[model samples]
Target: MTRNIAMKILLSFLILVAVSACASRQVALVPEDKPFSARKNAEIALLYWIDSLPHVLTTGVDNLIPSPARAAAFQSALEALLRDDPGLAATAAETAGYQVVIFNFGDIRFLALADSRHPGIGPTVIVNPNARRELIAGAPHPVFEEGVDIEAGLFVTRLEARAAIIAGAHACASSVASRCATADNVCPGNGSAPVRVSDAAHNTVLLYQLAHETLAHAWPDSIVFSLRGMMRADNAIVIFSDGSRRHAGVEALPNRLRDGVAATSLSSAGKIVSCQDADDDTLARRSFCGAGNVQGRFLNGSPDACSVDASASSGRFVHLEQGGIVLARLRSAAQLNLSGSAAENLLRGIAAVIPSSEMPMASPDSASGPGQDRR
Candidate 1:
């Protein structure tokens, strides 16, 4: 009687194992609709999977993760692309309920897990197993070791990556801060204000001085100026906020001005600037625009009513970076023993991009219209 009962229990265990194996082999069909195809109309979330914090100082493999500097560069470049393309709008990752999510693994490959909780969004493999194996082999320390099986390591890594993505999506969706801005003034502010000019580094001080000098000399009352101090191991940035780019009569001008601003800054700085139109090889080979470096973007072209604030109606977004033209110029000057005048010239070049004459006229009253107090 005891032997018969034991045999029956063993049979049940075997059946369970067989079912699990078959489920693992089954492939989930990708839906007919592409996830990011409607990105222009939908809110999308971006996730960067890096092991270290942005401020942590590390060497070699540690640099591969998306540090604060790298994240800022990628975000800036993406925003610029969306602004010029006229389709997608850039929303903060903190913004909730995004319809699509993009995971950037520092060029590493990852597989998407089947999400049973959301029907029809089953486990889909984003990267093929062969490709994933190759990436893992080349990946930095902690990803690959000498003795352990490579296949097992790859499987574990992929699972972890998928889990992180899902966790990030869930967190963003549930956070109260994720709601879209209802008014322009209520729009999210830049993460933090710039450091004091006196205590900042030489380059930072120079940029801060340039921002003020430009406002005072070039476009006083034309825009609100702010300095984005340098990121860790990154260059300083200056932001020129002209308010909402969307208004009743001149809806499209903000993007044009943004492009013009970037173009003028790049040309006048007298350095090679990278653009999305450049070939991948060219971008990869170039140090300034390469992975983990600064890349500028114009971010004020979204037409979605909920995506932007009332202040955005004034067309008030402009971002300037030291990574490309500015960084190159600074480096070259330091090597050549040149004076501080180079920084000044770069600032003036940026200032020249602002088209004060064509700026949208701001109403005198504070609470009058959408684009009021813009210029």
Candidate 2:
């Protein structure tokens, strides 16, 4: 009996040691708690962006409409996000393409700055295939200060380049004919006051930013117009199949139409950017699906399944956001990884944090109810 007891004790000791060693070796990607600086600086940048610029078109050529009323509404929504999660996150848009210059200059601008720094949301910039001719011509395009490369016409952009676009927009304000002319005034790390940019030029960069970070894939259906999501609800929730609920939203901003069914919801948070078709129709019962956010995927694979391959904090995402005027993403880090693969890390530094694997997700193609938050 004594021999047996001794053997059991030895086994227990070995098991404890093994467990400890494993725990010590597996590096923690996520912060035990959220950091305050990312959120704080981001907020300041947002405030400057909202307050500094003059009215420009948030719609038409781009998603950023310059009406004060629209900007006010955007401000309300973003501020609410900061209130909830300080380390904001990737917006609905994933790819920062040159097409954003025509984004109707809508909501893309504001969301870009909001995502730029906090977690350095994925800022990959690419020129539209069609715009290749123009880029070759160098027709006042949005370029970066440093750390950029062009391969197959795609721009591997960074913050400075993105900011240059914003500053260019400020120069092109409705009042003044300025533009984000140089890598000087607007880009970060230049000792600037962190001022915002113009309507058109900035809107262009914002669209670029959204593609990298802010606004996500424009809802591919006219039903998106009818959904009326986007910052509309302060309390967006994603209920999982396991009966768990989370504060999540979808990026279904209406700009164009594509394949998919409607996943309408009675909840306000699910709605991000609602736009009507030409002679825009609102009386129709057009539903929508989700692209991606903190709780979903970026640029959903099909109209049916919005995927969540990975979830990272912020900089750890690699989504390709199409141009648009609106979006909705996670303030939390894990969900933002939808852009590319949270399969790895979240932060660039030790920030590559992914959220719990078994988190809530919207139904990919659940056309059952009008209230299923399947974005």
Candidate 3:
């Protein structure tokens, strides 16, 4: 076990080195859906943070919702549980040169849903008792001295990624469903099953069902759009080489959950989540566009009812890390809000919780991309 842990640490170190080099490129950035400015890009690397254990679906994607038992399970899972199956698709994507890495912040932040109200969502910051009194003073949402975690971060923003994932899942389902048209057990591998969205699971589960269909493919490679800051679900910490590219997906969908406390298991290390655009068709483009095509959608599905104040709408994470919004922070911000005010006070508070600081930190002026500093 010791050796295994050591190897895991070593592997993480190597990845850190590679990702760091990529971040320093200072090359022209490309949109997530668009081709990389440079073609030799052998690998499409995706890095994200997750805070919880993803809910495990028992009766396939088709049945997770219609069955009241399943919904209860889903809601129950809203809090606890973690499994490692998404890696299967990640490996398959690697076949096509897609690299996906995840850092589990679950150790520092656990899975918790937003209050569904005006939740003060932002990067995890340490609030000095004094600072907390000043900024969060009259604010209903005070940065608690200790044991208070942001409930809605990347997890809630998943709605944006869901748009892309679902679109790809549909394409995958179409492909796999075609395989079983003539007979059962004809799909592929051990689980060549058909997906029926009409099965009546919750929308989220239904989306997963569509995504899981790609698993039946010899190689399920779909696109994953990480658009949570628009939803203000994450601290907006840029943990990937293409931080600017990833942030482009902002404001893609209606604030999926405009108001909530979102510090999720979404960015947790070792666990990767994304719905890749498995097929290159119109649906895929539209989905990606909807997620974040040039700061907003190309196709307007319906007027976004969530944003009461367009300026005040989501993007709360962007606000928390606003100053460095253009460039990736890679390091955690201590700013009180989007203004990117100094985080010194917040750090004093953070010392109480993360005194040792497993999370990375960067100075205000030096805006480097994501890396845990592998060297």
lDDT at 157 for candidate 1? 42
Please give the clash total of every predicted structure, in order.
Answer: 17, 72, 39
Off by over 4 Å in 1: 1-221, 229-314, 324-340, 355-365, 369-375
- Tens-place lDDT per residue, model 2, 1-375, is 133432332222211110110121111223233333432323222322222322222212232323444333333333322232212211211111111111101122211222221122112222211111111101011222110111111110111111211222222323332233222233234343322333221222333223222212111110111011121222222111100111122222221111011122212223212222222223212212222221222222222211232221111112111111112222111122223321111111111111112212122222332112323
Q: Model 1, range 19-62, lDDT digits (tens) per residue?
A: 11112232122333333332211101111112110111121111
Against the reference, the lDDT scores of all candidates come to 0.23, 0.21, 0.20
Tell me each candidate's TM-score.
Answer: 0.23, 0.19, 0.22
**Which residues of candidate 3, in runs, are more than 4 Å off?**
1-66, 79-287, 291-375
lDDT of 3 at 250: 21
lDDT of 1 at 325: 29
By summed lDDT, the worst window of 10 consecutive residues in model 1 runs over 290-299
Candidate 2: misplaced stretches above 4 Å?
1-42, 50-55, 58-210, 213-288, 291-375
- Candidates by lDDT, descending order: 1, 2, 3
